[model samples]
Target: MLVTPLTKLLGIRVPVVQGGMQWVGLPPLVAAVSNGGGLGILTALTQPNPEALRQAIRETHKLTSKPFGVNITLLPTINPPDYEGYARAAIEEGVRIFETAGNSPGKLIRYFKQNGCIVIHKCTTIRHAKSAIRLGVDVVSVDGFECAGHPGEEDIGGLVLLARAAQELNIPYIASGGVADGRGLAAVLALGAAGANMGTRFMCTVEAPIHQNIKEKIVASNEQDTVHIFRTLHNTARVFKNKVSTEVVAIERKPGGAKFEDVRELVSGARGKQVYETGDPDYGIWSAGVSVGLIKDIPTCEELLARMEKEAEDVIDGLVKVRVEKAKL
Candidate 1:
């Protein structure tokens, strides 16, 4: 019943698109979100390599026939994976929705457009969003400072950020950062967003392939449960606050300790993957949005999306009643 530009663009019933959480965006979770009537995005880099990503796509296809996407974050690294090879693999698997983030998506944008794919480039600043619009992206997933993963250095919250996006840009955007529940969905729609992109909240779902201990940890957390690491390096990331992350932050505060090598072990992605596999919440750098505090139960993707949709409708209906009626003046 709730429709928006995002829903139509993505050909999904709900305007919700699961944020592709790294190491956690597995096939089971992606397929569940798709089967639940929303677009699910697989994390391309989560696979070992391009060939592994192709196999992951094939695995997802076996679970559900619904449309899904792949998240290809084009960030710079010492040895970057072949981003183009991953895109080609996704295309070969019939994936038309592409979520591109990090670095400039210029080359990837052109390739996706040429292939008639809908590319949603996530950006933290309005300038980048405008640049992406000019660069031929289909939609912009506006990530505010409250988001998990790379929240950019701007540190602007979603409330102000979404308004800025609505004011300055012509393209439709989905609100990210701190968005988790039906009220958040309703709030974003009122603030002129097409929809929302959620990360932490989805991690607390049954479909999420992470350990149950991790899911419960997210559920037990509140807004204060997240801490920002990598700020010392100026490539800030929001992660679940824990012994490891806390230690990382403490080290960053020490004199001459802001270098990457100083806290590399605590924030290593390799260690983070072990945390996911072993269900140790304090093992390594694990990302979570402030919305983690809002998660109270671990529901299935279908149950969560269905309830969120109903709640959004209820809120929107309430808003519709706020119109002016004839009054004696």
Candidate 2:
């Protein structure tokens, strides 16, 4: 078995955690991952209110008795929802796991801990990881530049980031960004991570609520099919290459440069949600990681996670045999 600190901590059989993609972390997908022995996550702000989130949690419970988490990314939104209310709603529903990202997890950390919830904070740099550790977060999810969402300004890849984090971090961390299949999971284990956390990889799953055309687009994409936008704003996001995204990039690269308002309409969350519904890859800005290149087929979460687990075992067995052969020589 491929056991790690994450598996023990979350009480999950597999160490994998699905990314909390906005508009994509519906109950069906989350429950599927949980039922498949991995940790599924519900995006908090996806619901219109705390009551709606409560219903979603209850719905997920109906599907799987396994553990799942609610992700509440505390970012700067034009009209922010009641973030704490959503967290409390989940807490009241007996949810024990919390995945927090963006600006600061300071306030929510205290509440989560007081309620005996396990907090896994996502960070793109070593300093932020250290900060999360200092704040007593139970786990850290280290995201690299290849991550679909905000990858921070440093732009370091998973190999360098995960290796460095493994050497320095006293707490256990999982590798995020550019992870897709069992090979990626095995690579992260070698780099000292407990497991792999995938966003773009999960986007191609059969259970993903997004349109099938979007999944097909992801499968068709290569590594170079993604582009980095909002770099000038220092809030860099890696997304699939599409017409709207291309326009945003063009505006950002203008001679005089562009402002936040310049691309606000083109990159709004509503537009992205529409893209998810319509299956039009070129409709709006949507996050996709470099790992989209690694996706070749759409499988049910059960099939995907199970295959990865078997492949991980095979990889470890192969390595052990090689070591034995070398020792004999």
Candidate 3:
């Protein structure tokens, strides 16, 4: 495969990026993705403290010599959560890449650049992508409505979002959301994106730290199985359809009966931790992209990458063959 600016900037062999999934991007998982030829990312906030994040970075370094990154989500509600401290710690640990999500990165982007780390901020809309570019980020990871986590209220899909970003932004960017296979990858590339950032797809990989049961659930899911909840909070998350999420939606729709605090218990962060770690799907939160339906089997990071590359090559070649046949006519 031809190396793009994304691979060159990150110093990785492939353009694919392992999305920083909370509770899933541990040291072993991050190292595995890096070793498998993609830019692995550790979710920094998953660590209980800044010291724990430092330790995870050290462990990832011990596992692979390849490049990797750390993701820090700037949630505004957390009062003085020491986000800058975490960013400084990641820099001191020699992390070459940083993926920022959530609220405005603002000064954090300047800080990362000053520390000699390339910043890639995940944005759900073209406006946010422009903001990241204005903040001087090297790359942008555009997460469309089909992505897991907070897909924003605009609900724009990847194809339209990527094209819009390409038209408006000068900086190199990657397409995310609803991308899980080689065809998805080729489609993103053809859409003018430098590469694809995969979250749910990587979650099903063997290297992912989530329980095997969760991986199985992801594989078994179809496009119709996901539901977006918490829109009343102005924070929408795409979760696999379950009893809990269904109830959440139900409560939100009730006339003069639903309260944000009422559904808060069901969407607690601790509950998500339990579900992701213990595989107790019934009691905790399970995030999945609409692309989960397309996933049929669980594969190792290596196998997934190899298969995606081969299938993408076949797709590109097939397109060329069609063009050649047309010329003969």
Across 1-329, the per-residue lDDT of candidate 2 in tens digits comes to 78899999998988899989999999999999999989999998889899999999999999999999999999787787798899999999989999999877888888999999999999999999999988889999999988998999998999999999987899999999988988889889989999889888888999999999999998888889999999888888888889998999999999988999999999998999998899888889999998988999999999999999988888877887876444564
What residue pairs are clashing in model 1? none
Q: What is candidate 3's lDDT per residue for 1-329, written digit by digit as tens?
A: 74788888888877899998888889888888888888899999999888899999999999999999999998858475789888888988998799999886888998988877799999998898888999989999999999998888898988789989878989899988988998888888888888889999998988888888888988877899999998876788998888889999999888875677898899888998888878877776778899998999999998898888878778877777766443564
Q: Against the correct fold, how does model 1 do in TM-score?
A: 0.98
Location of the lowest summed lDDT over 10 successive residues in candidate 1 = 256-265
Kindly list the per-residue Cα lDDT of model 1 for residues 186-219, writing each as its tens digit. Answer: 9998888999999888888998988889988887
Off by over 4 Å in 2: 324-329
Query: lDDT per prediction?
Result: 0.91, 0.92, 0.87
- Model 2: how far is 276 from its true place, Å? 1.1
Error of 1 at 103 (Å): 0.6
Model 3, TM vs. native: 0.96
Winner on TM-score (2 vs 3): 2
TM-score of 2: 0.97
- How many steric overlaps are in each model, in order? 0, 0, 0
